[model samples]
Target chain A: MSRPLVLVVDDDILLVAMARSHLSAAGYSVADAQLGAEALDRLDERTPDAILLDIDLPDACGIDLLQRFKRRPELESVPVLMLTGKDDRESIVRAFEAGAIDYIRKPYIHYEMLARVGSQLRIGALMHELSERNGAMTRELDVAARVQRSFLPRVAEVAGATVAQRYRPTTALGGDMCGHFIAADGRLALFVLDIAGHGSGAAIVAVAASGVLQRAINERGLDAATLRGELSAFVDIERTGFYATLVVCMLDTRSGELQLLNWGHPPPLLLERGRTRWLSASGSPLGVGIGPACELQTLALGEGDRLLLYSDGVCDVARDGFELRAQALELALRDEPTPAAVAEAALAAAASETIEDDDMSLLVLQREAV
Target chain B: MATQVIGIEQGRLDTSSGDTLERRVADALAAGASEVAVSCGTLALVDSSGLGSLVRSLKRCRAQGVSFKLLDVTKPLLRLLEMTRLASAFEMEHSSRSGAKTSV
Candidate 1:
């Protein structure tokens, strides 16, 4: 491999010659420029591994050139060692602010200068490696986000109910997910789940959880208790140390029966006849310490009744007088008519004064009495 | 909403009613303010203790009849708040001179 190139830019010809001699002796290729303008011209012709710059150049100040170098994509990664006459703290700080990698006072000792240059070169190499890895990770996350989006159910009307849903990922890939499946016997199975963490790892666990839930639903046909047990088993087998809160419910249109299996998820809000009540089931969240069989809760749906299923991000609103999950749901459903309106209002009530750490997902289902 | 602006300079609040900054903020709330807006534009850097001070200020504001807001937060300070989720707790403005935006 060729020795690393070091470009020396200084108006002092003697100092430039001395630097070139020492650097060349120390296994480096040295290039020379008499002024800042000449250095810029040389930079256009060929890039150097590092720059040895003098603060008092004739054409321009070293700080200005450092700023210009930082703006150039190709040169930004090149380390710069600033040379000045004084060893004042202000000048050293100013050099750093201008993006210089290191600073040396004039009349420099050969060994110290060489050591500093070597250290900066090592930092530059490590930074380059890190940048390449970051680029690859970003591309992977983009693909993951696209796949997560596809997993969500599209906007559609259910035969016996109106459905409205919303999902917002906290990161490029999120742990929150919502899915709906309609059985041939006219039972609508809908669920909203929040995985423990955020980002790509959590997203992978969420996708896996969804797959497990879908397979169970496809085979068993919305049998609420069976589905819950299968999901719990899947979580136990995976052993990913990741937990999820889920609210799985099947709505039977013919009988107006709503059977729910809640696994440590926020309780659903049941709105009927201008009154609201919490619909909760006693089951542990999946992936916690394994326990007894998961139990299912059943409730009879009344005419013009709406059921709201959401992640904890909605129920955990921090505003005053909104601490209880029931209170937040009440504020959202107080003046909403349709299922869509209720979903929108709930999201608005959950909106914090700033960005939320976790993703928010909502599913609203309203039964139309025959 | 009522607005009350509190300014901090040299990393210290002018009100010295208590030893800790949080206690001073609580004292300020007790002195009759409904909506508290803290200005930290001049602050260079704040440690975790300073952040705790700010959180205490927010909690005090909430306990009182006042709402909590922040103004003139530098970028580094904003990053600290974001890391701790304190940014989500208060209404934050870019600068004291600029009007507070309705949303973040």
Candidate 2:
């Protein structure tokens, strides 16, 4: 509890003194600067809770000073109440245009001055408190994003294929998650999960699910069906109400035979030699207890083939329909045959003036077609 | 002024409408509607928020011991639900069997 501080910037000695005495008597700590340069120096030393700026200063135009003050990102929101002489309509209008939040005409009435100062102080305090809270929240989310990132595997060679992934969340933390597990028997198990909701809860679940499967898949090769079933059994939808559209596949790189199961996700696309094939949605998403009866399907991902797994965010790109999206995807793959290139092509179509519509994630596995 | 309740007509669900959609279904249940069915025939799109509303609606119905289901779900809406594996979350009267269409 110290009193709110006010910085008074004016060239008039008597007027500045009056303001300082009145504001101090009204429970405010006051500081005054006669020149605009002095006022700016005071500001650089430390930002006060509020500023009362005179519309005219001997050294510089207060309007110019106000513009400069507003330009600083840190002080953009601080309340600046312009002090204008009565009948100076142009100065009052110009002060506001330069970012003064409010103004009081001079021949400064003690009561009016105190009232304007008090109200501005309240708003300034509230804004400061809000920004502090937002800063703390952002820091916490950054840590959560880091933790979620750590659960994902490092980009490396799985069996004989080069594996790489790219994911972007709409927010600080997102629900879309992907992970790769290389089993003891050299089967590379890869999964891409998109949770139903966005933000912290979905992100937490995505990371947790990734961790669970990584441990389980690395222990003993869990077939695709059992992997989905075990994941479903592991969750209590009634309690957490969290479910994810995921596709998990085990690739035996040597033979290029991939055992795949997709629960409700966009099918993983398979690009081999000169042809392209879209993977179908073979089952239901996890956590709904839908008894999603899906049999494991085996597809050949021979040498020189690339398989791409992506979230539904990519599906939202095509304007006409799914057929258009498929055609675009196939062309991109045939042209470059790299996971990043095709994923980029899909995203460019989805790109709006705002730069994004939803979170997009891509995991690419390419078998060296020796 | 009479309160307006949104029925299952032609509203394509999105994040912006999720809360109102939740309240509308809750009100219908509160007013002693035995069974609530929403028609999704004209819905061209359903985003994550729209799906979120359906999940909440299902929860509210179970809590109030009333029945609620979706009707005439469009192919796009059904495809969205299927991809999310939410096809079994509701019982469809005109089950377009809208799901089960896979790629590749």
Candidate 3:
């Protein structure tokens, strides 16, 4: 291992030499700087593990310089040991407040200097290790977040109809997921689900659930009851005690027919001529005992008609009240905006409300003019 | 058999609270209460984790053959429960209802 580097800043040449000899003998690399400017220049060249800064310097006040060093992002964590006169009690206190880790009085004993330096070096090393470990954990979380994003569907167009979707998680990973695929019979199958919690555990369940639903939809093509059954079997609901609200839709593109099954999620909106109508749910959330028969509701979509699906997070917060938030959303859609514009406006409105943060996902589909 | 009324004071029951509600219910059962009623009069929000805790507690009550119910359910919570089809699964009384029995 490389010897821990120590930067010693003092106006006294003899004291600098003495500290250097003792620290070098005790397995430390010593760098000397007489002025605060010299010390900053040395920092620019290389970062030291610990700094031995004198309270009195030629060019700058040592405490002020210490504060400057602490302000720098790269040198903030480096241990700073202040060198003070034995009677300078106020400077000692000021040095500490200015971010000095430890201090040694002037006319110091060689052994005492060595001991303080050694102890601080060990602490600095431990802090460095902890910082590195946290960095590694954050990198791993970012990778998991990327993997989660990969599963999100990029359904810009489905069967000649325009589609736009957005997902915003309260954390690096969230439980909200949406996907779409066109069937051989010209029907577009799309889905949006929100697992009960947020974070890695919920995200893991979300990924598993997404895979299961994706497979079932591709194979069977929009069987709400069978899809629910498959999810009940696949998810270890008993072990995890987790559940999710989902909406599955199959739209016959040629005939403008839309089939929707909402399971315990927020009601989807049917937007027509700048007005909004809620398509409310009748079924229970999944993994909650499969209690009731989930009913599939069929509707007819006219030209220029749009469907908006969103997670509960978008609508949970209240304005004057929760009901007002829905009305605010309706007012935003009054201009008959595109899917993306509608999403942007809804998110802006949601941002203005104060409430607990949850994963928000919005998917909008609009039929083209005939 | 005595009824134990446990009130939820917090506005939200979510991942941050972990399994506090479940633990409270477990404590009620351990204390030999034959019935448990959570007074959600102050509760305004519940996420998936909170819902999970409720379900787990309900299942625990069922396993021990104890009666469990939620009292003073808020409109927002009721909407969530109804949408999730949990309203039927849980025996709940609306907040406006009167004359329900309570024991300390």
Candidate 4:
């Protein structure tokens, strides 16, 4: 790394020379400005690690100079030490109020100058490192957010079926995910899953769980019991208190038959002929020490039937500080022309209320009557 | 042997509160309590992480040969437990629907 640069502004040429000798000897690069204008020129040329401003300048007041330095966004965090001859309470307070971080009386010891300058340089280096880390973290989150977005089921043109999906993460990374794949048996298998938290940690778990679930689906086929057992093994290696609730549904387009495996998620809604039915059959969430095998719930869809699956975050929407009931959610899904419109209506209702605190995901599968 | 009771407040038992529950259970067990029961009268939400915390606490209790129970579970929480098949995992006391106020 390059050496820290210290800019010293003073009318006293002798004092400037003394400071430069001591600071340079102590491994800091020093710049001297005899006038306030010269200091501004130096700042414009390149940013320094710290500034030492003499309170009485040839062309400008040091307090005013400090304020000017602070006004520039790039120099706002740079430490400025005020050098003053007067030790009066008013001038010291004025220096501080004007944004000088520290005040040193004139004729100070050279060792004190070196010590304070060294300390401020150290602090500046640490702050720069912290800022860099924060930037890196933000970039990583953006990539993770993109990866999470890719996990969502894309609009597939399945014969005799219409599919729509919506996702909103409460943070840069969300704990919710939805995915689908065509099974070997020619059934369309889709799942909506929610991890236990909202953020990067939960997002990582959600992605990992998605991979594990996909592998399980490929190996276990459409057997809910076998898939649950496979996930149980995956949970053993996860963090002690990390788990995910999932709902997986397989639709046979040829027969209009739907098979659902609800693993501790909110019950899915089946809409038919202006009425709603809740498929409430559910088992323990994946990773809670395998209890009973999840019971597969089956439903035969007639023409123009709709199946809506969502994370609990969607149904937990509150209006005017009151949480809406599942029935209200079902009502939101009513009369929507297409799967996309159904998702939009529910999201609109959720947005009208207080903002949801969790990640929200919705998937709608409709059987084409025609 | 004394039975320790941990009352769950109105907030959720999600990722943020899971560690606290585990710590409370550890403290209770360290205090020589032979049994630990969580009272869920006002708990509004229990997610998968919350359930995992409970399962971890139950495992700890069993390793120490202590009994773990749930007391006064609300209807919504009961449904979650039942749906997750965790109702059969622990011994539950009188539930809120049962209208019985039994001590641990």
Best by lDDT: 3
lDDT of 1 by residue, B14-96 (tens): 22311255554565566665666677766554532354456556655765657777777766566544433345456887653
Which candidate achieves the best DockQ against the true structure? 3
State the lDDT of candidate 1 residue by residue for A1-370, as single tens digits.
7899999999999999999999999999988899888998888978899999987788897888888888898898899999888655676688899888888898999899999998998898899899999999999888889999898754476667778888888788988889777854568888887776677777887887787786776677656566656666445412554566677888897688988877656678888776888765455556543333346677887777888888866764222233444475776765687777888877776774232655889988888866
Task: For residues A200-223, write the lDDT of model 4, one tens digit per residue.
Answer: 877877887777777777667657
Candidate order by decreasing lDDT: 3, 4, 2, 1
lDDT of 1 at B43: 57
Task: Classify candidate 1 by CAPRI docking class.
Answer: incorrect
Order of the predicted models by DockQ, top scorer first? 3, 4, 2, 1
Cα shift from native, residue A221, model 2 (Å): 2.6
Error of 2 at A82 (Å): 1.9
Model 4 docking grade: acceptable
DockQ of each: 0.02, 0.28, 0.46, 0.34
Q: Pull out the clashing pairs in model 1.
A: B34-B66
Which candidate, 2 or 4, has the higher TM-score? 4
Considering TM-score, where higher is better, how would the candidates rank from best to worst? 3, 4, 2, 1
The sequence of per-residue lDDT tens digits that candidate 3 reaches over residues A1-370 is 9899999999999999999999999888999999999999999999998999999898999999999999999888899999998787999899899898899998889999889988888888888899899999989999999999899866556655777778888888988888666754557877888888788988988988888887787788777878888888534346666788899898887788899988878888887765679887878778876457678899988777888888877887211367877886776655546877888887777777754477888877888753
Q: Lowest-lDDT window of 10 residues in candidate 1 chain A?
A: A316-325
Query: How far in Å is the alpha carbon of B41 misplaced in model 2?
Result: 4.0
